[model samples]
Target: MLIKKIKRRIYNLFHPIQGELWCLHRVLNEKSVFDENKDLEISPDYLETKIKHYKANNFDFISIDDVYSKRLSEFRYCWQKKFINITFDDGFEDIYNNAYPILKKYNIPFTIYLSTDFVDRKPLIWWLVLERIVLTKENVVLSSGVIYTCPDIISKRSVFKQLCDLIYNEPDNPADTFRRLFSNYVSYFEEKTANTLTWEQILEMCDSGFCTIGSHTVTHPVLTRQQENEVRREIEESKRIIEKKLQQEVLHFSYPYSFWNEQVQDIVLESGYKTAAMGYGGSCRYNKDNVYKLPRVYLVEEST
Candidate 1:
């Protein structure tokens, strides 16, 4: 392990990454061990540790706009100055409650990609509902007559992953499919508590000057599976809604679930977004051609 670590350090020293755009989902205190989306979250302590580590390592913390400008600049004077930008997807209220304070402490500039419908209290956040059902009920019987029995944390996690795969890969509308599957158990739409960031919270973040708003589509649909018009509407209308709500031109976007094709890419370009982030791919290299498809590393607890 020591040898491998030394080798990696040497390799990285010679071939440093241009920038790292971290894609984070939620920053909150952990809940149940059986939480299916546990991987999507990291504790506030972990987030602070990451920020401190990067700062100690000489990584220049910057915004997505800085990323765009640096990548576009033809002159290369400071190749050794590595940069990292942080961004959150889905506009979760946990960010405002948990991550915001830590980020503010460090004076970090981050971006939040908002799905308008989520903020609008729409039933699009089906995954959280699905988790609640699995945890509360020992046996869940889908409307399709398929039954999942999650008697323990291990089984609960298994069931959640299985159902989540089905939801994401569902040929029909995934959100609608979630409702149809759980129609008998509970109504997916009416959450008594707000889970997403409100426009008020968003406005406050905007005022902070440390937060940048980006579009994550109106309903956070898998664009590749959607109809051409639906895809266009999801990409274009989301930009419009966010721009109007924030009263600022939304220049950046992120694919819902990182599911996109060339057609989806074209729509983002046509929609006038300067850049779009995706779920996977490691540190971003300065590439002018990949402006629309800027890759990001998901900053889970395991991320370095």
Candidate 2:
């Protein structure tokens, strides 16, 4: 973490962020109920603090569009004027439920990279599925006679990571591989309670002039894990679907789970995203930077 902060500062020195993008996942409504992944969420109060901090710090809050369009010829060593662009990945409904009002109140311009499948309800998000399966039940047996038990939170977390790696290593259809394992332990899992943002909610935000929705891909698979053709299809299909559904040009793409490579970057450009955000944590002079691999810093409140 310290190393990353150093690198971010170093990168910012050269490609000073006229409009730097900071990424977040969810802003939690209930701390206890949605407590499975605190790493992915922050209280709305904390988010409010962050907004107020930037406001007081003389930072200009700008949109991703502004980064690409307005701020090109302004890199300096003594960078006095800084900008913050907010982005959220995974399309959590909590952003609409909790974060949006605060952001709207502050008049912040932010973008959401929507995982279309999570919103569409075709397949379950595998990580969430794994968390539930491991946490809610103590002794678990797989269909293949593999025995697993998570007697405590630490054990459960470790088990979840193991399952995550197993799923990630699958050569074909990781989602299906996860589904088969999850189905074996189905009774312990409840239906997904924290729903994704609906089209109605998204449209309302779009009309409000504060929200910009971008594609995070259908099924939210790791792009590098799939075949070449499938990778292209994921890129093209997601952009096409969002534009068709939202009636807005989905001009930006964020690689699902911040996973991308040379091939993935090319596919994103070919599919016509004006900019693609990645989470390697740095800022770039966006004048004519590599739009396909725009680096973004993950924003979480510092621990006291």
Task: Name the best candidate (by lDDT).
Answer: 1
Per-model CA lDDT versus the true structure: 0.83, 0.77
**Candidate 2 weakest ten by summed lDDT:** 29-38
Give the per-residue lDDT of model 2 (tens digit) for 1-304: 9999999887766666555688888897454222335557788889999899889988888877776666545564435777788899988788899989998999999899988876746346566766666767797667677877789877777777677778777765666787676667665445764678888888888889988988898778889878989898888887888889888788888987677789888888888888899865666663536778787777765444
Worst 10 residues of 1 by lDDT: 70-79
Question: Could you tell me how far off, in angstroms, the CA of residue 75 lies in candidate 1 after the best superposition?
Answer: 6.3
Which stretches in model 2 have alpha-carbon errors above 4 Å? 1-14, 17-19, 29-36, 120-123, 172-174, 187-190, 285-289, 302-304
Model 1 C-alpha lDDT per residue in residues 1-304, reported as the tens digit of each score: 9999999877665544687889998887754454447678898999999999999988888888887876444334344667788999988898999999999999999999999887847445777778778878889899988899999978888998899888877787688889878887665457542378889999998899899999999888878888899999998898888888888999999998898789999989998999998988877754333877888888767533
Model 1 misplacement above 4 A: 1-16, 72-79, 120-122, 192-194, 302-304
The candidate that wins on TM-score is 1
